[model samples]
Target: MKRDPDFPLVRNLVITLFATNGHLIDMGNRLVRPAGLTTAWWQVMGALGYAPAPLTVAQIARNMGLTRQGVQRVVDLLAARGYVALEPNPHHQRARLVALTAHGRAALEAAEGAAAAVDQRIIERIGTERLATALAVLGEMRDLILEELAQSATPSNDPTLSIENEE
Candidate 1:
């Protein structure tokens, strides 16, 4: 396959993104540890906290770009700890809506507080404009990747969509 001229740069970007994700998750785990929450648990709780209403496991998974099974496991653990409550979904009979309890809100707030200093430090070092630009670029890249994923998942007659073609 003839590689794109920017392939190397794109490869480096992807590698950096993967490494950064790992580092961020590690940092999040450390920050949230005092609240008795792992990074995964914190993420799930954050999703619930940000939502306008309680969400089903499947809905949370979709919003977080996670597998439903994985979110289900986290939700189960959260519920067992009394951090979250699962109520019947009005729309779906089986998929229960997961809502953060008062305890869960406190835990999430603690995690956010712990991370606030780190976030401020990062912003101070990186500058708000640069961070904003980076965020926009990352959002664009994510959208493009999602488009590719959706296209690949669907049956297509277009030859350009073949694996042998350059991305």
Candidate 2:
């Protein structure tokens, strides 16, 4: 079968995006580590902090585009450390609401300050305009990818989706 002429360009873009994501995650981990947070922990905490009210583990997972079990693990860890508190959910009997405690809020604020410093450094190196353009392009790419996924009938585990052709 003949491949689309644009396939190579798309493939290269995907590879670059993956590499960039890794670098960004590494930077995030470094920035938040001093605050006693990993990138995943920071992300979950940020989501809860920004929300109007507390959220269940499943709700936080959905907001962060992660698995419930993954979010649950982090929530449990945070709870154990007194960074977050689990409250009885009026809406659900089993799923408790998770809220940031004073300690969690303080940690998140510290992490945000550290992140802001990193952002300033990056902005100085890249310029705000270029960074804005890059963000816009990334958002467009994400939307296009979502659209493609919505339209695609191919099974996620299909061998044809693999980088290397399978026999």
Q: Model 1 scores what on Cα lDDT?
A: 0.89
Model 1 over residues 50-156: C-alpha lDDT tens digits? 99999988778878888777988999999999999989877767777899999999999999999999999999999999999999999899899888977776337
TM-scores for the candidates: 0.88, 0.75
Per-candidate local distance difference test: 0.89, 0.86
Tens digits of per-residue lDDT for model 2, 72-141: 8999999999989999999777878999999999999999999998788889999999999988988898
| Residue 158 in model 1: lDDT | 55
Q: Which candidate is the best by lDDT?
A: 1
Off-target runs (Cα >4 Å) in candidate 1 are: 155-167
In candidate 2, residue 149 scores what lDDT?
57
Error of 2 at 89 (Å): 2.4
Name the Cα RMSD for model 2: 7.4
